[model samples]
Target: MSEAKMNPMHELSDNVAVPFEQARAMPPSVYTSTEFLEQELDKVFRQDWLCAGRSSSLPNPGDYTTMEIAGEPIMVLRDRDGSLRAQSNVCRHRMSTLLEGRGTVKSIVCPYHAWTYNLDGSLRGAPAMMHNTAFCKSEISLPTIRCEDWKGWIMVALNPDATPVGEGLAEVDALIGHYGMENYVESFCETHRWNTNWKVLAENFMESYHLPVCHAGTIGGTVDLEKMTCPEGRPAFNYHWILKDNTMPLTLAHPNNTHLVGDDRNKTYLLSIYPALLITLTPGYFWYLSLQPDGPDHVNILFGGGLAPEFRDDPEAATHFKALKTLLDEVNDEDRGCTEKVYRGLCAKSAEPGLLSHLERPNFDFARYLNAKIQGEG
Candidate 1:
């Protein structure tokens, strides 16, 4: 299918024929399709520049970590020259698995045949293979993946022809420049496996409609849901929802956080970048959520958040951070519950695609974005 046929933005707009005050909801297939999920993994996750981990995780040379993207194991390591590199974790010879988990390794050796690769993914040695006539050491380097570090986040792209991370994120860079993310330290990180499809989680993160009912105790009281707005006309790669609370002004009184006074103090900005990255930039801290699909109906949600480095030394700041973490945890649990229920509903024979609400432009934009990419439109 052509991109234009798949992403009829004008048709989408006309079909929903209502003012912003009366927008409908998205179709339910977005939450339920196993086939659709597979296409997303190929077109969106595999093709887009995804936020994988923070540069701080590999602070020293030889530090390395492994993660899966679109079911492919990816190895990311800091080389001897202190440069970060990402490569497919499969050995060039016999396709053996090379590494697992995070650690400091001078070189990665494939357990199957002991083929060793340097941190830069170059073939360091293949002990017994040097004697073989057909073996070529120079031609056996592990396949390298594209990687870029921006504001402490390490992003990787699996597609060799994919757009550069800098170009894809140029707008986000400008939007979040004031957050000073480089000065932030990751203090909390956790992951949870869900029995729901990945799209459910992505859709949940893209819209704020459920906040008033679902997160009533945690963040609903603080967010001005009625004032929420989403990015329009641009690529559906980014979405933003703002929450302003009155207590935000007093929050600046906390030590080392005077910089977030007045208009900036109480606002919470939630942004979902296409397929699997979700970032929440708050007054004194930020949250990064990475979603990875495990199967047709399962997903891994990795969560990380922390206070800016300037506030890291204060005991009072730690207490505040803990409270915020607890609140976020509660809200996440609420989402998990809903996603599972939605998953069950999607499996029903009577299930049909739904509508899009005007307030759900973020969610609609995300669906449109997915359609474009899957159809090679975007």
Candidate 2:
């Protein structure tokens, strides 16, 4: 393709070159173009360390969860030795998918051919393969993908040389280490497909400017927008803060908590780990969305959250979680409407970029990150 045809986002490169105060939303093509989405699949999603879910989700041997990243079926499982492992979910024989959704199993058995494999992904049994001289059970094993239990998140990378998740997020750990995020128990996780570009949802999470209006029925009134801070982002991530003083006890520092004090006790962090792990970390609870592009027009989300250790065993823990989940679902519903509308507007020929607000500094940073990755500058 010619240079003009290859570069879909005329606005993206320009947005990255200017100062944050002068930045604007990415051009509509950034969200509507099929070509641009393919480029992202190759350069961003395929090469980045993608979060699968929380490590605690698969606690015992044989427990597992499955997800697709950049069109590759991946399964993260707890091996027999009590280690987290990721491998191709596709069966070697007949190329069938070995697993579906999340569950525990003694071993991987291909539903197509009844071919059996151990928890480690090594082939154990294959029927009627003796006639084939090339069949080697010893050599037939599911391809191993790079997997890491970074803090508590299960991260996997398709690119063998991708930066280690821990090293990439070292600064993040330093920023929120006192919260002991790794120990937070994940109470629920569910998958949903949304009709909006992944970037729209990501950018929404990066700012609080729309919270009061967009989340009016849920957390809108609870947020003090003036107290929020949107600073310039780092190479691997962007972050902002919301100082909350709310009725939700799980969002504030628990009585048993000693790590945070004063304003930090009610502080909430909105962290966007490029290319798509968005975390909402609080003193008492945490939630996150791990995103993947279904196409230019849709995104697949793994949404999950739970309480900090201090609140998990409280007598009212169950009730608190139920309320939290209810609130979250409402918030998500509001977000879905907003983002989908934005996408619909983008798809129109008259769509144009708009200037960013100070609260959208993280959104601007995210644009720069996408520009760098797709242009091979990162």
Candidate 3:
């Protein structure tokens, strides 16, 4: 909660300026180079705690979900006692992937060989070959990964030596206590594969610079751009964007409009957990945006929204939910369209990393954070 002790490795070089005055765009290699992307998989994704799935997916014992972290197939399953456990999807014998996607399974069976593992990743069975081969069933278990469920979100880590996920995200939990995210249920979820650099998408979400240009129709009229301010002295680890209630009519009126409008105004706070997770806290709902890179120029964006318990069952709430989704979809389409073009432009030799605007302090701060991490400064 106490800011998670800012990555201690961050040290300012004499030449490096503080209170960054300008925004500098990232190099093209960051987007188009396979080499850089691979380094990211190792240096960043593997070492950081990533929001893999929602806890609701694995609510009951035996429920499981397969997730890909830094291209490694991993599975999270609920044990018989209802505790969540994560293990490599690779078979211990031949190293073939175990789970395909997500489903309930009493036990995991490897397709290549009949190597069966329990929900806790212990070897439960190896039908025939075990008798002939000097295989120790106790030692022939699937490798396990660190798994943690906090505030209804499931997080996974690839590196065995990485810091505990609870330590990394402790600050975030304390910051959103009032939201009571853990109590909210997952109302909707959707995923889209976009052709854009993952960092580009992440950086875009960290700032509101493009809102007026891209989301003018949906959120432009609804949010007040002037009131938006990125906290100073914090290096933009998180952000709070203030939005005023619609001067224009609500595109779709919400069921309980009382809490929707606060003194005829509303504020939407957008917070970006460094690296990949973005959380949008609104009066009526909470939306989570998680980005996972497929390649240097490709990314998968997962959208999850949580609704208050009372509204989850109300029919009118459904209408507002659909409206929110439509509104967000429109904004997402715009971002994807623009980022894809940015990818193309970055491929051009004439293109170079551009500077950030003063208004884009959040993006600049995020870029600094990433640059530091990539350089092993954090």
Give the runs in model 1 whose Cα sits over 4 Å from its true position: 1-24, 231-233, 246-255, 258-261
TM-scores for the candidates:
0.87, 0.97, 0.86
Candidate order by TM-score, decreasing, is: 2, 1, 3
Q: What digit string (tens of lDDT, one per residue) describes model 2 on residues 3-95?
A: 753467555686678887788888888898898898899999999999999999999999999999888999999999999999999999899
Per-residue CA lDDT of candidate 3, range 1-378, in tens?
133222212211211344567446655656777766776787788888788668986788888877787888988899899888888889988899988766888788989877888888889988786466677788777788888887788888887886776676676666555556676667677778988889888877777877877777667666656777776414325676665565532331234544334432255667887678888766556678788899877898778886655456567767756766776678778888888888889889897666667667776666566666667877
**Model 2 stretches with alpha carbons more than 4 Å out:** 1-6
Q: For residues 245-321, what per-residue lDDT tens digits would candidate 1 score against the true structure?
A: 65543223235666665655556667777668888776667778888988768888778887766556666766767
lDDT of model 3, residue 292: 87
Per-candidate total of colliding backbone pairs:
10, 0, 4
| Model 2 residue 293 distance off true place after TM-score fit, in angstroms | 0.6
* Worst window of 10 by summed lDDT in candidate 1: 4-13
**Highest TM-score scorer:** 2
Which of the two candidates, 1 or 3, achieves a greater TM-score against the reference?
Answer: 1
Better of 1 and 2 by TM-score: 2
Model 1 local distance difference test score: 0.73
lDDT of each: 0.73, 0.91, 0.71
